[model samples]
Target chain A: MSEADQGAVVDLLGVLAYAELTAFDRLAEDARMAPTLTGRAALARMAAAEITHHVRLTERLVELGADPSAAMAPFTSALDTFHESTRPSTWLEGLVKAYVGDGLAADFYREIAEFLPDPDRALVLEVLDDTGHADFAVREVRAAIAADRRLAGRLALWGRRLVGEAITRSQAVIAEHDRLADLIVTGTGDLAGIGRLIERITDAHTERMKALGLRP
Target chain B: MSEADQGAVVDLLGVLAYAELTAFDRLAEDARMAPTLTGRAALARMAAAEITHHVRLTERLVELGADPSAAMAPFTSALDTFHESTRPSTWLEGLVKAYVGDGLAADFYREIAEFLPDPDRALVLEVLDDTGHADFAVREVRAAIAADRRLAGRLALWGRRLVGEAITRSQAVIAEHDRLADLIVTGTGDLAGIGRLIERITDAHTERMKALGLRP
Candidate 1:
């Protein structure tokens, strides 16, 4: 890879590292909202998984001669803003966010991983693997919606808002980092490819919503 | 073991399980206070270890035919109160609490583990094993104290307060759970054994404080 490509990979890894760290933080916080000890433990496990991924990504950055903290610094604000703006107000909202929000982010990253080489691409895909939250969240959310039909409406709205905020912050992050933008644009082969990427992510998000028994 | 003995063991395991769960929660919260990403990751790792212990304990509860959540419920108020009363106000205070506070609690549990049978005793000791937080907390606390001498004084007092609150809540938990109290008394062989146990725990706490450059 060229030096520019390496730098772009670093940027990608850095953002992903910070993203995992924040996800760990947010998931642990959301665990507090769980209605049962079993549910709480489940969310806490997911949080732990995110931290482990964060550690792996940080180690990879160090191996690449990047200062992990310095590399992660630039992307923190955008990610933090994304979480802050979409802060879940209730237990079910939190579940929906964890499921729909994280699923969306993972989908976006997996799309980008198609642009990278060995090791980096492998690491990205591995870290993006589901941390057992999907089935748990789907079961819990579907059950809750079944008990209270009104929840589906609110949660459906919440899911849409989560995706909207995710896309907004993600775009802002890519715009602020030119190397990352260049990598995305080049890897996709054209502006149209970027369009296709968004379309694919949105399609996945709709499928996730439908799985949760919510309107897309 | 007899039914009553089994009940006592269940109570003991319940309290320990809840303790680990709350430790995960507080440690994750405390990670936010860390000054750097490295420090944050360290604390978050410790938090993850706690949750893993919590999972093991909960699984043990299930194996023993006890409802993990119900078994854990009785001790939550006391444990929550202890945490509420000694909530760390700063990063260093948080480190000291993680070190000194958790150390004291672990010491007390180890003393009681002597009465338990093979798997229970082994399980208690294993979950109580240091989660890498000891060295991390010691290094951070001592370094901070060396740089700011005033930290020793406040953290020393903080250490004392942590023990005090811990002792108070522990007594409340014991008083409220007769079977657990019986297990301790029977396990110790006499009431004097309980006194010796407290002394042993206190001594260990003093050693831990000294290790962190704090007054006992």
Candidate 2:
């Protein structure tokens, strides 16, 4: 890999690892808010999957001879800000955060994985959430909305806010890291292609929201 | 199950469920203190296992037509007190707690499992940490002690404090719940038998501490 490409990959891995760590922390805390033990356990299980991803990325960083902490440090503030801005207040909000926020992040990562090189590319692909989680989240959100139609509006707004924060932080990442920006532009071949990828993610997210009878 | 036996079983399940939930919370928090990605990931994996156990216990409560939260509520304060009194101060302390504390708890539960009926018995049996986790904790604690002989004194004291609190609370549980006490006494079939079981647990624990070069 080119020096610039290697740096970008390192940056991406760092962000992903730290994100996983923080997600686990947040979800574990949120699990306490669950109204039922079943709900709590489900959230906890989801959080656990993030830890596994964190381990894989950290291992890859070690193989690359990079200091994982140092690599993760740069994106910590931005990532923390995203989570802080979108901190869920209630059980449903927590579920929305996990279901909607994580769903979007996973989608973005899936697209990005296509652009990464060899080993890192494969690792990213492997870490992405599978269909089971997405389906579970869909069922949960739908059930929650069906229970209280009023929640649909509030959770939809929350989902949109989460997506907005994610996009804002993502743009900041691009602005601060030239190599990362270069990787995206080079891998996708233009801003339009990247924009189209975002559009696809948004479209799927909208369908999910609408399925739950929420405005996208 | 008899009416009284069912109540006692629910009480035990409640205690175990809450313990798993709180352990998940504490371990997730402790993961942040880890100096390396590998260490952090290790703690996170442990946290995940706790959540899995929580799920299994909660499911059993539901199967019994018990309210999971109600079943878990009675022992909340006592368990909380135990953890608060023995909170770890450092990464090494955290590892020691995870190794020694969890080891003792698992041993106690294994003995108690023989008293439970059918599915609950099987569930408790299955929920105990696999040998892999025990080996990991033992290896980590032993390596830490081998590297720093001075840590032995402090860690040994901590281990004793942990056991002291555990036993005190355990006795309180038995004293307050006649059915549970009866279960234990009947399960083992005499004072001497129970004494021998306690001795076996202590011996194993001392062996573990010795392996870590900590004074038993």
Candidate 3:
């Protein structure tokens, strides 16, 4: 691998490791917003799952001779911005973010993971598995929207905002981390390949939104 | 089993299930107060452990044909008040609360567990295992105190406040919920047994505080 390619691998793993840790943190905090104890514990379960995923990624980073903390430090601001800008105010909103926002992220990562070679691709593929979490969020959000039809409009707007903010943060990442971007293009062997990857991400995100009864 | 004994068992499990869930929530929230990413992950690991214990208790409640949610509802206010009244302002304070507050709770619960018959006693004993988490908190708090002697005075006061708040809530629980409290007494076979139980709890709390360099 080229030096730039190596940098990109580090960047990807670092971003992913921090992302899982932060997801665990935010989901735990979001559980407090749940109206029912049952709902609260459900969210906490999902949060706990994130920790296991985080452990797997950290192990991978360590095996690669990287300090997990230092590897994770670079993309902290971008992910933090995404979460801060899109903090969910209601339980439904929280579920939508979990289902929609994270679904989009996983879709994007899966697309990128395809470009990785050998075991890295398999490892990334393995960790990106969603563990059927979206089903719970989908059922919860869809039921809430059904009970209060007006929630449909507000939540639909919330879903759009979530996507918008996700895109905004993602674009910042692409702009600022040219090495990582170059790695994607070079890994795919063409610029058009990156274009198709973006298109695939957008398509999958639309499906996730529809699953949550929100318009993408 | 007497009908009243059965009710008490339900009450105990319900209260404990909720406590475990809330501990997971509050600990996850407290993790945000951690100064470093490494420290934050440590707390998150601790938070995840609470979920496993919570799941076990909930399973037992289900096996008894009780609705876990309804069972846990009664103790919600007490635990919430304890947490709200004792929200830790700093990382060290949070560590102290996690170590001292939870250590005391486990000690008390273990005493109560001994009063339970057979399976329940074994179940509670299984759940109360701390797995050396207190050592981490004690080390962190003591190192912080050593770094700043003035912090010792402030944290000592925090430790006292923690115990005070914990006791006040425990008193409220005993006053408000006769079923569970009666279980402790009748199960112990006398008031002296309960009195000795309290003394044992007090002794353990003092040891926990001393471990952290605080006077109980």
List of clashing residue pairs for candidate 2 = none
* Residue-level lDDT for A213 in candidate 3: 83
How many pairs collide in each candidate, listed in order? 0, 0, 0
Candidate 3 lDDT, B1-216, residue by residue in tens? 778877888888888899899899888999998888878888888888898889899899899889999999999999998999999999999999899889989887887777777798899889889866667888898898888889888888998898889888998898898987787777777888778888888898889888998877
- Candidate with top lDDT is 1
DockQ per model, Cα? 0.76, 0.50, 0.73
State, as a TM-score between 0 and 1, how close model 1 is to the true structure.
Answer: 0.97
Tens digits of per-residue lDDT, candidate 3, A118-150, equal: 577788888888787668888898898889889
User: Could you tell which candidate, 1 or 3, scores higher by TM-score?
Assistant: 1
Q: Candidate 2 residues A54-122, lDDT tens each?
A: 888988998988888888888889988998898899988887788778778878877877888888999
Model 1, position B186, has a per-residue lDDT of: 86
lDDT for residue A7 in candidate 2, whole number 0-100: 88
The CA-based lDDT of model 2 is what? 0.82
Model 1 spans with C-alpha error above 4 angstroms: none
**Per-model C-alpha RMSD:** 1.3, 3.6, 2.0
lDDT of 1 by residue, B69-122 (tens): 999999888998889888899999999999999999999888888888879999
